[model samples]
Target: MLTEEMMTTTEMILMTYLFEIDEWLKDKKVIQQQQAQLTKEELVTVIKNDLTTFQANQATDYEKKLQTTLTTLEALSEAQFQKMKLEILSWGPNVKHVD
Candidate 1:
């Protein structure tokens, strides 16, 4: 994901896959928002099963996504990680990086 260098064909394809993953992550968040319809007026027990299912699914999905992200990062050499040091440091704690 170097900004300065032109990506190789494989890198371009991988980038597309990463972008797709990012989009799916965003879309899943929306789905979660829709599913999490808690009301102050009334709480229902029926929602519990669905909520539990969603939580479990989301946790599993997140773990898979994290592993995929780690794979991309783990491919990078130390120099590459250094090149991305500033960007990684700039990110809040949620973003993972080698540095």
Candidate 2:
């Protein structure tokens, strides 16, 4: 029942709609890709910050442990020196009092 002019008009309308839909889809894809890239960059920054914090904490813990070990060694050395001094003193007159 459609005339030739009506068929041509309908075809033109359909083509316009299809072109608009295609353009919208392409824009959507570009926006999605940009969002994905931003998310990846944010994640990388967070991971790097976390790694830096972890390394700092590890270094602090190591220093604390090393200090504790040094303190313990110094105490043990002092106690041993005192024990040797007492042993020598207990020998009384038999031990020489060398300067």
Candidate 2 accuracy as TM-score: 0.20
Compose the digit string of candidate 1's lDDT tens values, residues 1-99. 532222232232223222344644454211223212322111122223333544553466434443344444455665553444333224332344342
lDDT of 1: 0.35
Clash totals for all candidate models: 0, 0
lDDT of 2 by residue, 20-56 (tens): 4354445421122322232323423443444355565
Candidate 1 runs further than 4 Å off: 1-59, 91-99
Summing lDDT over every window of 10 consecutive residues in candidate 1, give the lowest-scoring window: 35-44
Give each model a TM-score. Answer: 0.30, 0.20
Residue 13 lDDT (model 1): 26
- Model 2, C-alpha of 89: deviation from truth (Å): 99
lDDT of each: 0.35, 0.35
